[model samples]
Target: MNAYCFTYLFTINYLVVSVIEQMTDARQSYSIAIKNICQSFKESVEKVESIKKDSDTNNNNEILYNFWHVFIEKFQNEAELHENVIQETKAKVVTPLQCIVKHRRQQISRLKAFRTSTDYTLKECAEKVNELQSNYAEMYRIHREILQTKAIKDLLNAHNSYVLQLHMTNAMKAYYHKFVLPQLMQEFEGIVRENIIGFVQIFEYFCSIHTNMFDQLICNINGVQLKVREVSPDSVVSVIVHNLNKNQNPTHWQLIEYLSPDCDCPEILCSNQIIVDNLVKVELRDKFSELKRQFAELSSFMQQNVNIVDTLKTLEKRFDFDTQTEHINLNMHDDIYRKENEIRKAKIALAGIEVQESSNRYATHQEMHSHSSR
Candidate 1:
């Protein structure tokens, strides 16, 4: 019976030590994996920051778009792998450790009760020996039963699923908020800058065309006329204001005279201004059409990019990663607290048994009885 008792303690103590060691190793591995994930995430953020810097400096839309596409593909793949690791750790490592801690605590309580028993007789001891053997078998069965319980299985599934979702939420927050959103905004600004530059160039091109057509019209009329007189700035301004106030669209020649107050030009009648405006309009029609087409294309592209930014904002709000992470952390803290308390209680019980064993020696029932009688 004493031998059986020692055997039970040895087996249980070995199991407890093994479980503790396994838990320690598993936790260490998980910590390293989490560290690696954080480091990789930092690296990815830095890469994106560098890309933004490049886009700002170089203003290369093609390069920025291409890099963004490639980076997203790679980042998503890595995030999926990290998510798998989180789920796997929760299911395979966390679940088993929780079960083992529970079962070990129950075993410890039973062992302590049996060892501290004060009643001993030859018949009773024999029955106790049989009971001890039954207990050992029951311990194994209980372990298996606890593992097969619906509650344990449910806990395992729920924890794993939650962990996976938490990881995914975190990934989305990192990718979209930190990475994608900033880049999209930067790119949109760059696009706007390019559009402004394009519009300025188009305005300059049209101004040059109108000036050349004005010069040609003036020269043609002057070649046939016998006299040419310098037009006064006051006269030009009065004509422009009068024509504009009358809701008459100024001819290209009138527009040029209005634009260039310092220019020396011959005075022109409204009918010639109308003819010059018609010629200039015909020359500019194709350029204006091309500018409108380009403007529409650019506007559509800008709108599409704007939509992406808005969509990302919606996802950023929806994910609420910080709250999800906080919830997971709280649950983890609770689990750790429970497990640590269970281990502390088991250790105290084991220490008590050790003290009893060392102080009394492995005395047999007869020896214990003699000592008690004395």
Candidate 2:
């Protein structure tokens, strides 16, 4: 190989080394994130277990113990699934990535060192071979072949070894590209499916536990509703009357008047009462507008509710009427059909036409024409 090839290789290596260092940093950060998630998960599980254990000791804690008992079991299943994902990620991606980084750095350094030395030797070997070839005719013309010449044999062996080393490096690069890289990438790419989709499935199961708890509570509520009668607002007045004491004074509490301030004026030099009157009038006008706006809002809200209630009542009445009149409507339809059939029979009689009850089939237009002609 040429000297420039080695120089280019070193340049590429320098650029790639920076990138690999960044990858290493990213891997370390990713590892820390996984650790944090696992640690937080562990603490949460411990808290749940602790709560469950404490609740179990209290014999009267029905809902708490039962809830945690089911919760802990569900959490265990979720945790196990989460742990599997973590292990898979570490095995398939994280650890493999780490090894790739180490192996890559080693290979880059080794290849550069070996190739640089081999290229230097290659230049010298080419010069040696050229010199020997150039002097071969003169040396043979002068003397016979030299015996015990170690230099020629050593030079050839060194060239062969260097060439073999280059070939081996190429083969190693090919194998990695074909097999190792593709396999690692295939495993690494499934990070989404293994972690994201797997976590989704696990979390879906987790949420179902809460759904089941809510369903059970709803069932309890429905049971209570079924056993009890609905209370009416009008019954509150009757209840109050029933509980009232006859001996107690009717007006127990009175409105306490806070002393209103008087104007700082002498008796002989008093101002007109128009100050208080005008202020009261303006305040009352403002209060009236504010109260009217509030009342309008409430009125609109109440009207909307009333309209909804009325529509619902109308629907109820319509449903009830349909149920009650269903048979009558059916009977009326039957009578109308009966009268229409009778009228058709009378018309047939007036027209002096008779249909055969024995034959099921009626004559076609062509057959009727033929019969009429006959």
Candidate 3:
């Protein structure tokens, strides 16, 4: 009986110890799993923190780089603006001044020849006078046309410059207000106004010249009939003059004068009492008709050359302000295109960095979990 009881007690105690050992082993495994999980979580957090720090550093660096790049870009833009202004000014003022100087020199030589002639035959003297007059007329025509065209071009340039300056100044003001005025600001309105006023004065002067030239052209045409009648007879000349007045008004006659040879009729023709006046009238009328036809052909040829409806086509092919303005506008458009492209590239680079940072963060979290499990 005693043996049986001791055996049962021992068996029960052994079973209880086995169960307790199993429970302790299970608890130890659970503790180890929890410890590993906590370690993995800590490592993951450290990795995430490191990644965040790296991302922050990278973001800061990128910001600094972008800031420096923007600063450099602005500096370069400012320098380019100054360079463009100088080039534009030179093209507008210096180039035209040089052209004017060269034209004046040629005019002076022709005037000198007219002043220095000693002895000449009647024909030679007339030819020389005609040559002088033709040169003067040509110079006057060229100068007048060139000045008119230049004034228009300069006015456009001045307006464009003013607009560009206004835009640049406004951009600068905006930049200053956004980025500079919070720390350091200065007033630039006076300087900007000075430049604008100077340019306005230049524009006003060009306008004045344009107005004067317009008035001069009107005056030049006004006395054409009187001048023609002074050199030719009333009866004979009246027919040609009337025809000229009929076919082409006074304005058209001025163009005809530019094309036709200057007729130096004898002063006797002006008087009422002239021998064979009818015959002379008929002959002069015939000549005048021929002259009108020739003038029409010459005017047509000039119009073809100039791309304008006039007898002054020679000035079109010549280098002028319009050509220069066209060139500058083309350059400005190209510059704007290039700047836009650069800005696009910068935004693309920033996006790429963001994508790379996201991919790296995911990979870093996975690596941290694997290491903690080990």
Q: What is every candidate's alpha-carbon RMSD to the true fold?
A: 47.0, 50.0, 47.5
Candidate 1 all-Cα RMSD:
47.0
Candidate 1, pairs of clashing residues: none
The per-model lDDT (C-alpha) reads 0.34, 0.33, 0.31
Candidate 3 clashes between residue pairs 3 or more apart in a chain or in different chains:
none
Ten residues in sequence with the least summed lDDT for candidate 1: 252-261
Runs with alpha carbons beyond 4 Å of true place in candidate 1? 1-148, 215-374
* Candidate 2 vs candidate 3, lDDT winner: 2
The list of candidate 3 runs beyond 4 A from truth reads 1-84, 118-374
| Model 3 per-residue lDDT tens digits across residues 1-374 | 11222222222223222322232233334434433433433443344335436541212112212222222222221111112223433444334433333332333333223222211212242344345445433443444435465443433333222222222233333332343322210112222223223323432332233234444323332332223223212232233223323433221001111121123323332221211222233433453355356545544543443343122223323434344554543344334333332332233222323333333344346556767999
Clashes of 1: 0
For model 2, the run of ten residues with the poorest summed lDDT: 352-361
Number of clashing residue pairs, candidate 3: 0
Candidate 2 lDDT over 1-374, as tens digits, reads 12222222223223223322333233344544433443444454465446536531222222222332333233232211222233434333334333333433443344334434433433444444344433432333333234224433332333222332332233333433344334333432332123223322332332433345444334333332222222221332232223322222322111112111123322311311111122233443453355356545545554554565455444444442132454454344334333333332233222211111101012123345666899
Clashes of each: 0, 0, 0
Q: Which of the numbered candidates is closest to the native, going by highest TM-score? A: 2
lDDT of 2 at 34: 35
Query: Residues 1-374, candidate 1, lDDT per residue (tens digit)?
Result: 12222222223323323332343343345445433544544454455456546532322232223322332232222211222333444444334434433443444344334323311211243343344334433443444445545543433333222222222233333333343334433432333343223322332332233235444323332321211122222332233233323542212111111111112322331111111132233423443354346545545554554565555444445443233344444344344333333333333233323322322232224345666899
Give the candidates in order of TM-score, highest first.
Answer: 2, 1, 3
Residue 45, model 1, lDDT: 43
The C-alpha TM-scores of every prediction are 0.20, 0.21, 0.16
**Cα displacement (Å) at residue 113, model 2:** 25
